[model samples]
Target chain A: MAILDVRDLNKSFGGLQAVKDVGFRVTAGSIKALIGPNGAGKTTLFNLISGVLSPDSGTILFGEMPVQGMKPHQIAEKGIARTFQHIRLFPKMTAIENIMIGRHTHSRAGFISGMLSLPGTWKEESRIRNRSREIMEFLGISSLAESESTSLAYGQQRIVELGRALACEPKLLLLDEPAAGLNMKETAEMADLITKVRDLGITVLLVEHDMSLVMNISDEVIVLSYGEKIADDVPLAIQKNAEVIRVYLGEADA
Target chain B: MTRNRHLQVFLLIAVIIATQLATMLTDTQHYLTQLTMSGYYALVIIGLCLLIGYAGQISLGHAGFFAIGGYTSAFLTTYDLSPVRDKAFIVLLSRMGLLVSTEDLYGGQVLHLHPWAAFLIAIICTIIIAYAVGGPVLKLKGHYLAMATLGFGTIVYKVVLGTEGLGAADGISDVPGFTLLPGSEVSGKLSQRITNYYIAWGLVIFGMVLLLNLVHSRVGRALRSIHGAEDAANAMGINTGRYKLNMFVISAVFAAIGGVFLTHYNGGIGPSEASIMKSVRYVAIVAVGGMANLWGALVMGSVLNFLSLRGYFGSYDDAVFGVILIIIMLFTPEGLLRRDLFSDIREVFGTGKDRGERA
Candidate 1:
């Protein structure tokens, strides 16, 4: 079953066609990698799917419902949660508070009830707090729960972002350059975490530039170039594809 | 976290008790009156603190809401009526257990509403107007938002100054005091000073408790997240726009409540109450108190407003606020009593290093 299906998607910025007729499908509980060279419109594609930017023309079906023009929060409520290429944690808040904000959709306390501190509000708050702690522990950053997000190390901040996304309990997780600035050991741990996320029955759609991490963990790979889909296949086949070699690796070497 | 929260609540209760005790010991009517006025200002400052400090939104038109509230109550309570209509209304009010009698003035009749009724009506009107205005105004960011709200305040001030029915430049006068206990023959003017003092402080405490509860809840976390990163908050399934609007409306309501109480307590509503300087003073108080710290806003609001009431700044109150704001912005932008500053002060005193380390 496809958790996400995009068809004939297009986006433009004035004279620049940032994304053109791009399309893909991610099977439920599968790890899918979106790989391309710089300026291949990979991030633009992510933005379209996450509802940050609307496509000029396309259809995006998260399940059976079309989510083309939905707001970001609405899409998130529909079980689609995303992390940014640059970490966007709330800087002054503790790691636990950042993660708890991810549980917003799952809770229903509003202004009046929250002000009164009703019994139901307290119950929901305790539940969210416990869940936030569990997510931090799962990401191996439980000790950083009380630390401000900006005060954390780069790798730890990335982990905190992941924990925040996971606290949403998303059916589909969008990880944009999750291992962008990590060292070798941190990249390995991130790869392990991504696999664990898939094993937990959540579909993962990743945009990454790290070839080793992509080829090792991806059940399937989709490649793009010049805002167009170039290749879509298993990782082994993508490495052997002639067009991918000429346009991606050939250009890199030259 | 829970322990710190408990300590905060205990400290707040202690402060309330101490203020009441001090009022009794001093037995100075003038001082008590000044403190009561400070309580009114504190209400406005707390709301501004929540909007600017927690939600990261700014409003320079809170005095517009304040004016609206004051004028609403003033108009309802002090409107003159014909003798026949007044007599009929008096009979109706008496049947409803609201009025004991009606007073005659200058060959005409004056029918005053129950003070509580005027207060409720003012609040409801302010809420509606705020809801209508906040949707469009809250969308602008930063300084643009401030400019837009300033425009709103200026428009309201001009309207109140030009309208004769609202008393034009003279404003409405002789507003009635709140009757403490309902359904009694006694008038609201018998123990007006002490009654108004406690009522003002009581409302201030209630506002403080509500604000503290809000900031400690899940919704408060969402607001803090919006303050830190709006896009991130939106991505996390929090509706950033809705939260901002909600905060704006809530803050406006707080200002309105303060305006109503102050108008009744002062026995008049004036154009000066709607001045832009009044709103700026509120923002200054919140900034001096420390934007995100509730206690800081409360303490700074009360102390500074009380000082002004005591004629310390004389006629240069606005100038004093302007200088204080600039200094705080340049040197201690985090606020006068920021958490880190407290720790640093302790360090200088050569004690509580363990507490500093914990922070």
Candidate 2:
């Protein structure tokens, strides 16, 4: 079953149509890659799915329920979480604290209980702390838990950002340019991590500039050019498609 | 952290007692009046610190909330109901024991709300105003947020200065004392000066404890996340807007409570209390305290307010605050008391041990 379905999605930025007539579906627990060159509306699509921008006209169904035009936090509560194309960690906080923020949806202790220092609030706090640690350990960054997030290395900061998203216990995880600034080794490890995340029952959706990373692990691939999708198929077919070669690979070669 | 926080509070309690004892031993009991007033102003400072530091929002209208509380209670308690005492609503309120009967200087019968009823009404009114103002004002960011709140403070100042029934520029005076117990009333009477000092500082300590607890909890973590990155926090399922709005209201309530008690303590409140300069002074204190440090805000709030209230800055009070605000903004927008600055200072003094420890 598709966990998310975007139907006839359309978005315009004044005179510029950023995304047009786009439709796609991601099956449960599968890794889907959204690949396109710059200005192909990949980030725009991610924003629409994450509710950063409402569609001009479209229906976004998550888990078969309409979620278009809802607030970002509301979409997240419905079990969709996404990281940024650029790193956006809470610079002043520790890595573990950054992850525990993801558990905000899971923890319900409010300002009153927190101020009163109620027993339930304490219990929930400890649980969130321990769970955040577990997520860091899962990402192999347990040793960096106490360091401030921004002070960490660039690759590790990316991992920390992914850990923050994972802490939300998302059903559908969106990764935008997860390997953009990484070296080859870090990119490979990120691909491994993405696979690990999918194996843990998450449905992974990603927009990546690195073709090798996309072709290495994606179960299915979707290609876009100038705000319109050009292909949707398995990795081998996407690599061999003539239309993709003309608009994507041909541009890359030049 | 828990033990350290309690230790800080205990230290504050010791300081409160020591200051009172020192004042009495030196025959300088008059200082208690300024100290008491300083405690109330510090209440407003710490609340502003929470909004500016944690919630990542700026509000210049807190003085408006303060004036709302002061003026509401002052108006309700001073407005005589004798002319309409026979009305069903007045009689009902009288029967409900919400009305107080006293005598003016001419010995005529006067009827009005008891201080307790007026105080409750004042707080409720502050909450209502805060929610209404905060909902729209918090949606703005950066300098726009500052401008909106400044406008709010100015409007309150104008309304209070021009309203005929609110005593205009003369403000409300001869307000009745708030009798919390048999002898412990919130008033400026010299006999009760020491009691009022403890009352005011005790409330400050209570507020500090509550705020400390809040900043260390899940809600506190969420607030920092919003401050650090609002859009990222929202994508992670944190309701940034609701948190910002609620924080605005909470801080406004703190300011209002300070206004209510301080008005009763001083036996009146003036339009100047709601002035934009007062609001700017508060923001200046919060900036000096370090944007996100509650403890720093408390200490700075207390010392600065005391100095100003005691006339240390003389006629240049607002100018002094304005200069401090400009300097902080120009050189240390992150605030003056951050941990890194302390570490740097220690290094300069050759007392550093944890150099490069943040790494």
Candidate 3:
């Protein structure tokens, strides 16, 4: 069954329709790559799906519920977690603290319980810490656990950001341009990390400009141009699809 | 989390007690007097510390709450009805279990109480008013928020100035002293002065401890996240509005507590107490201390208050405060305890090298 289903999702900024009739689906435990050139509305789609902005039209179903009008955070509670295009970790916080914040949605402790440091507060806190550490270790960034997020190198910050999203223990994870600034080695690590994330039985929907990473890991690839979905198929088919080349690669060559 | 906090508290209490004992033995009455005011100002400054340092929100109207607490206490205390007429409310509330007589409202049998009760009442009042005011004002960012809060301070000053019962333009006097505690024999000017010193210090410590715990808690983390990026914080499932509102209330509570002590410290209040200039003093204190560090806030609070009290630069103390704030903004930008400086110092001290190394 599809974990996330988007149908004719529409969003417009003034005169620019950032996302137009964009629809896609991800089967549970599969990696789906949404690829397009710059301003192809990939990031905008992420925002709508993540509920940062309400879509102008159409529907976003996470599991069985229509999640179109929910707040970004409410959507997060409903099991959709995301990372940003630019790394947006809480800069001054320690890495473990950053990941702990991601667990906030899952935390049953109310503000008073956390504030009062009640018995259950510490128990939940330790659980959060252990889980955060496990996610950090899983992403191979365990050693950076105590460091401040901003003090880390760019690649390491990216990994920690992933760990932060994973700490939420979401059913579906949306990654926006995770390979944006990585070098070849870092990108390879990112690919391995993405594979590891999928291995955890979580649905993955990602936006990337890196064709190598997209083709290597994505179970299905959807191509977009000017907010319109032009192609949807396996990575091999998307690689050969004429319109995918004509729009995305054509813009690249230009 | 609970490990060393109590030790920190004990050490703080020990330090305050030592200062009092030192003053008593050496009879450094002048220093004690100054520390009294310093203590109150420090409490208020620490309040700003939480607002500016952790929540990353700016306020230029803290003195408004300070004045509100002071004037409320002064007005209610000094207007003592004679026992015959004062017998009016006492009979009514006593039967109702409220047990409030006119005497209780206006000094009653307690020592610093008239002022103390007013201080408590004013703090509660200020929280309500601050919530009302801050809810909308906090939405505006940067200089706009500053300007809005400055206007609020000015408006408060004007209201205090216009209300003749609250000392009108001249200011209230004979504002009575603070009760050392509930129903204590700590009366008389000298005793009240000593009591005020300790009480002020106690409140300052309270503000610091409360803010420090807040900064380390999940709320603090959420506030920091919002400060870093509001949109991202929302994406992370934090209720930015609720967090900001909570911070506004917490900051107000701290300011109100400080104001309560301040009312007793001055034993009188005026429109000048809540003036825009006074609010500016608080922002300056926060900036000098360090925007993000609680200890920096406390240290800055003491240093700034001490310098002002000493009249260090020939009555240019306020000007000196303004200059220091400007210099920090222009040069340090990170205040006396810059976040970067801590890291650099930690590196030199050899404690933070490993923390930053693996990253």
Top-lDDT structure, candidate number: 2
Worst window of 10 by summed lDDT in candidate 2 chain B? B350-359
> Candidate 2's error at B157, in angstroms?
0.3
lDDT of 2 by residue, A1-254 (tens): 99999999999999999999999999999999998879999999999999999999989999879999999999999999999999999979999999999999999999899889899998999999999999999999999999999999999999999999999999999999999899999999999999999999999999998889999999999999999999999999988899998988775642
TM-score of predicted chain B versus true chain B for each candidate: 0.88, 0.95, 0.83
Better of 1 and 2 by DockQ: 1
Tell me which residue pairs clash in candidate 3.
Answer: B53-B291, B103-B108, B112-B178, B112-B179
Between prediction 1 and prediction 2, the one with superior TM-score is 2
Stretches of candidate 1 above 4 Å error? A251-254, B2-7, B83-101, B183-190, B342-359
> Which CAPRI category fits model 2?
high
Give the worst 10-residue stretch by lDDT in candidate 1 chain B.
B182-191
Residue B47 of model 2, lDDT score: 89
- Per residue, candidate 1 scores C-alpha lDDT tens digits across B76-138 of 777744345547766776568554235655654465666777788999998998888889988
Maximum-TM-score candidate: 2
**Alpha carbon lDDT of each predicted model:** 0.87, 0.93, 0.78
Model 3 TM: 0.88
How much is A105 displaced in model 3, in angstroms?
1.5
Q: Please give the lDDT score for candidate 3.
A: 0.78
